[model samples]
Target chain A: MASEAENANQAPDEESIISDFFVPLARDWPGAYGLADDCATIAVAPGHELVIKTDPIRAGVHFFSDDSPADIAWKALAVNVSDLASKAARPVAYTLAISFPEQPSRSWLGDFTAGLSEAQEHFGCGLIGGDTDHATGPMSLAITVLGEVPIGKMVRRVTPSVGDRIFVSGTLGDAALGLRIRANMVDGKKPEQMTDHESLLVDRYLRPKPYLELRSALRAYATAAMDLSDGLGKDLGRMCRASGTGAAVYEPDIPLSDAFMAVAPESLEERRSLISSGDDYEVLCTVRADNVANFVALAASGGVVVTEIGIVRTEPGVTIIDKAGEAQDWAGRGYDHFS
Target chain B: MASEAENANQAPDEESIISDFFVPLARDWPGAYGLADDCATIAVAPGHELVIKTDPIRAGVHFFSDDSPADIAWKALAVNVSDLASKAARPVAYTLAISFPEQPSRSWLGDFTAGLSEAQEHFGCGLIGGDTDHATGPMSLAITVLGEVPIGKMVRRVTPSVGDRIFVSGTLGDAALGLRIRANMVDGKKPEQMTDHESLLVDRYLRPKPYLELRSALRAYATAAMDLSDGLGKDLGRMCRASGTGAAVYEPDIPLSDAFMAVAPESLEERRSLISSGDDYEVLCTVRADNVANFVALAASGGVVVTEIGIVRTEPGVTIIDKAGEAQDWAGRGYDHFS
Candidate 1:
């Protein structure tokens, strides 16, 4: 797989990376070098406790077979740490268990480590401990990230109230559009596919950003929040379910960007399509309607994108309004693990 | 699958389990909810911290396909925690991911959860997180356990000196022999199948107790140590490799239960075979000769078996002598993960 990449004849396989990358995790880590053991030990200290989360990336399921190893590593940690951000947690440590196809090339490992290094650097997360091995076939990358949150302030999903207004950070649907581009689709993706926006969207697919910078503000302002994965429509469905309230989202109110406008244009059909497409790693949140203006203003001061998209209602179902003021039809959209 | 399981059945439909069993992980683990994001929140705690470990259990590789689900769960945690015990760490929590075939039986899942609950209760370990999904085929279980240890006290497989006495806790070969029993070869496992002494041998196989009680003392007294997952021959070879030492064993001095006499009274070959079989799950430590007698007596008082199997030597090779002073030849006898 490493040999086949079109560019970068250099792959991730290097002895230096093996030695330099993970040594300190064992040297300075609380319970490093705990071989043949259940867990490496962490000695809790004042003002810091363990933050932990796990997510699985499976071969041929989460990524294309041809995707670079670096991307795989990035997504593995990014997805897990993104959860930390929602709780306003500061990531401190992470461990990885990667099972690869037997005799995998060393460059693949090198690229994977580079991705991990990049993400860790971005988040100030240290590589604490991990394990690796060869499996019969298929690759499964499982990561557990440990972070830190201030005492008594970690966010929860069940905090949205009936009168809360729904807000979203960043643009949605780009990742799903990127998926279309990867599959060689032209018309289905937003109009921007004809231009350089294609690259931006595709990058979103390959490397969804972890919004570590937004954690503190989220803890301060948003009553409830989650990253928009599995599509805005489906994931919003999850949040509403958790908070026990219904929602009414106005399509025209959703915040769109120049990148999105250049791609989506102002078509009613195109706007409807964005609701159900998955893989946008933006934050969807709820706040009292009275705070929407201040929330947007505060987020803008921080240089983050926040748009009021909807409101929580007394009823218990997600309702979407089209640009033409008609109710939009819903379908079985979004990725379901079984379906 | 649910039909045969009984009154308390997990949803038989694969879709329901995907949504119900795995999804509830977010609800059950408040630390990981991260406000309904892709990952969970983690942080370092005051006076304590995070430790990480990952271990794999493959079908037909680690356990038989026909083993009950409950037993499989117990074995999975047992093997992983056995490593923690060797390090004298207190298990804090764990995350589990299962890559399983489609259409597993309902009885299997119920049993699997039962086993997990049983082991968790026994070890005082709570499962904080996990992922479950369908693999292409075959069953694979990977569990990552986290434990707590005091700063600077966790043990490792290093630091043994040339003169350290090599020690092993608990009996060997019984679990290996137990495998033989599971395979319908009752040659030496069952007590009634042989004599009274041999029955005790069978007990060792069914549930090989890990030396959790000895963890603290070893952390204080031992130079280097490892769990005897494989046989003494190979596991000791590993300890020597890590510590850069050789060993000399007085063959007749190796502890042998009278079970050997009952199972194979006249067969020296059978005795050797029993010794070499793996899955002992005992702790193998390299202790200074000065501490040898004291260590043995200390562990014995705790109602656990501890024996001096050999001595670390300045010579750069392993040497074994029989009762008659004749050199005894043995191959690398232990479990090899890969052929």
Candidate 2:
């Protein structure tokens, strides 16, 4: 899209920005036309369909404005890729629409595009086409990712049956804890962190590594799936509502990382609150009883940890079993932007 | 994407927003799963490829922040559709990622979704999936459109031959003039009451109707094509440079609308400047000398008025021939956001 007003003369021209920064990221994709054309083309295999997702993040809204540009770029792509991974799709290409409040220095763009290059290589996708513009607000990026999945094979969030066992990948609440740690640092409530666990937690908050390797296993055995974005409690409630069922999650079974254990509050209430704080990009899935062993084994073979944390039920809302063996309602407890 | 912070309590929740305002937009697309799934799936026809473009617009940057929400929604989708139309592709679906600085009123969202509904009907496409967030900046929308064209048949912006005749759809400067009118109104230079011509110009600025009916003619006849968002001089220069050719555009042959002529300044220089000022959203294309007659006839049959404005040249730059028949360099004169 074209901006209505000409920007300050200090910024680099659009042509140079594309040629010097974005063009290299697009070199691997022939269909990108070297970013010289208005649109990009993608060819889907005969029996495959395209899975599409668009997610955008803004500075100060999603991340601090002073955060590293490379981390910002990676998070923007990673979030969208995480959705594709949960759908059991293999990413093919992506388009990036970026808005800058002012002209960024060459070093910032260099680190940003370098981050994009690294992400594309890691995820096995390439840049196709995009739009860049000057904004009257904070810097924002919207990335639309295209992935391929066999027809009728995508793991949907609305397909879980009453007897399905719920599982989650990796650990939960690490990013949430990481975010809190950063908030304390910004508030001067803590000294410059010295703990390795604190650093690990902050890294988790900065860059989420989407588990693309588990796509095959999920597609083969999961009855329903979605990425844990809005916290497991609320997102699982959404899935259950869509599937016309409910779930029972065991608090003791909810996986927590070593870093989270080392740095988080000791109170069970606070721990539970952090668990539902969202930003966990891990895949949340449900498998039939008969396929649980196979799904677990396959995911394990791919070096992805799968922890059974819950079970689908005939009830209409999600319940979390406390360590004391009492069932407590936990539906709608995840992060809500408008709440 | 999940927002990291909770917004003020005054706004409607995200769940209600999606179900009330957006779910209807996805009703026709089964792969959208009623907007309940994490991602949407698209199936391409056997002999076709997907043509994708992502263009985003922001309040205060692309349009006035107080612009009608309906008009804002329409322009966001129309600009992207215009690009696909220039590629001779049929828009199939689109994903919209929107950020609002605060929770918008129900009435505002109602009008916005209605506008999206109207646009989808107008363009023969459906909304698939998207993300909504509360921003700390101006409201912005990033729309990614997916269109389809026969394999290897998408019009290229890099294929114009030396002898090809250049053509452009519709008029040249109505939108540019309209934008000027809007700026004057904002600046209190224009009266509150607008002439019908001025009103028409403003409408052109607000909502661009993509010339999609001419896609068949373009796919069959045009050697190269691109949408004129950055004005004829600069965009044509881009096509020429990419195709390794030059162009000579005749000033007398440039088309203008009755509304533009009635309200625009009478000076030849100012008229030429407006013609080069960007935001036309029209198609600029090239046809082989032998195909010009057929292309014109077919475009005319489709109710599209395509004017022959120039011819491709063996020289190395775009030159505008004045009414007095003197060639003047007019390259790189279009809107550059960073300029």
Candidate 3:
């Protein structure tokens, strides 16, 4: 055990941090070896394969430095869970690798691990293994999630047929608008006080609740699927290009939350901006025209509302129809980290 | 496809980077979907379980920022592969998530991916999936490796018996000395010129070759095993504590490379320092007294040299016996990131 004298001039060492805080998250998984082993083992059921996804978030780039440690932990895991959901897989385990610029306070670590515990419980997964190190830059987290599905059953993002109907889970644009509102507040351009609707938008940005309930519907009916991380316009373009197809989306059908509508104006530019922004974390998928009714009904039964926003076309690009019925190409219009 | 015009103002966007540099690494794995899908699936053979490990490295912390990108890539994957080897598992696939402070140049990315290609081929694994994002901090790479072992056959780190003989594969302390040499060079405390032995030590620090050939031997005969990343003295203490046992290591029996001996003085303090530094990446295990001969023969047949360094004890701490036969406790004497 690590004593206070051993770390008199610093925070707890790596061994102490893992033993004191992270070990509880691994208690439910026998193969984790209580985080004592170098590697963790998972037994895959017969006739099933493991689905894997990794998405890392960095401080200031993915979340604000001032955000609650619990929220940061939740967001890190939720984004990876969102990807697994898009693949129609059930998450079973995850590994978190964190790098800290400085030694974190014990209180901060307590809150962070508490948040991780809550996240693992909510996602129905266990923490199997991870690594912690000191960094000379901002803190960052890279989470790799492991899910399972029957052999050859994971939904593919490149199998959408030309005439399939394109659908999206949950309301779009709330997270993006929430990000904008937060940015305004950070810049001191907006009032310090926010309305409840504005707070909802900010909440959407901070904590994206992935639509894991839609996994069954997607696996059963969707022909192709992917999570909407880079906004509908850009991500849809990627799906269409990969499938050798195109899409024609109706602008007026884009779903918006009550909070988004309550805060933002109803201008065409606003709609386009929302569609082009990133961080939705919703599932974007294509279903066979014949299976649309069944897919919608199954998703609704699971308490998830999926909206048909467009139809895949034979052409090779994405077209967004304006309220005036004018079709405009909207390909490659989303957040680009390098741009 | 992303065009030049789309990235005229900055580095190529994430899509172009994935398509141009990363997709080729995933071509060998069918489930990778050419890096087009959000997640990848891996089918485990019947009666086998998946072993997983993740270890991330940060620039300026784990490696110098001026180091070659290819070496950086190799070290990132090799470290995680070392963990899987310790569990007696055969690596199959891996996911890489990299966050860059700024968009890397095209040439830098080319070398980085080429290095990954070389490592995957050498390690008998394939790239499955990954994520790339911009960071406001230093560059970091988090690699998660997936391996396979027969059900209930994984060599654990917490099952060493009190009477087992502790062994380690390969020579120790070369990498630690190499790191010190590099640090001295960076600080201008040493001359720019280096001897051949010094260069060899530096090479060990830059790229560690894990003792993967010992996997079969360990699975067949070892009672407990783990990779030695945090020096023998500290890692052995962890193993002992986890298994409710202790260890008595012979200082004279500790293996040292010719390069390390030629450069490092033959002093007790130097030996202790070498045994307390991190980043060895060698396999450490304990074999039953009855199986020691067979284990040694099996490891030798695979061209790996196993050194009998100690014996597991009934007590609860690690002791290193000096030339004078005086036993000194060295339980918590390894590198700690926060300290």
Where does model 1 exceed 4 Å of error?
A1-39, A185-195, A255-277, A290-298, A329-332, B1-50, B103-105, B180-208, B249-278, B314-338
> What CAPRI class is candidate 3?
medium
Better of 1 and 2 by lDDT: 2
Number of the top candidate by lDDT? Answer: 2
| DockQ-superior candidate, 2 or 3 | 3
Please identify model 3 stretches exceeding 4 Å from their true place: A1-10, A187-193, A329-331, B1-11, B186-193, B329-331
Please give, for residues A1-339, the per-residue lDDT of candidate 3 as tens digits: 667555444467788889988999999998888999889999998899999999998887788877789989999999999999898999999999999888886678888989989988999999999999888777898999999999999999988998899999988889888888888787664534888899888888888888889988999999999999888988998888988899999988988898988887688677678867889999999999999999999999999999999999998889888789998766458888777
The number of clashing residue pairs in model 1 is 38
Q: For residues B1-339, what per-residue lDDT tens digits would candidate 2 score against the true structure?
A: 434233223356798889988999999999898999999999999999999999898887678777778989999999999999999999999999999888887778887998888988999999999988887678899999999999988998989999999999999899989888888788554545888999889889889999999998999899999999988999999999987899999988999999999999999778888999888999999999999999999999999999999999999789999889998766558888777
lDDT of each: 0.67, 0.90, 0.88
Of all true interface contacts, what fraction is found in model 2? 0.91
In model 3, the fraction of reference contacts reproduced equals 0.93
Please give, for residues A278-301, the per-residue lDDT of candidate 2 as tens digits: 889999999999999999999999
What lDDT score is found at residue B237 in candidate 2? Answer: 92
Q: Write the per-residue lDDT of candidate 3 for residues B124-174, one digit (tens) a residue.
A: 999999988887677889999999999999999989998999999998888
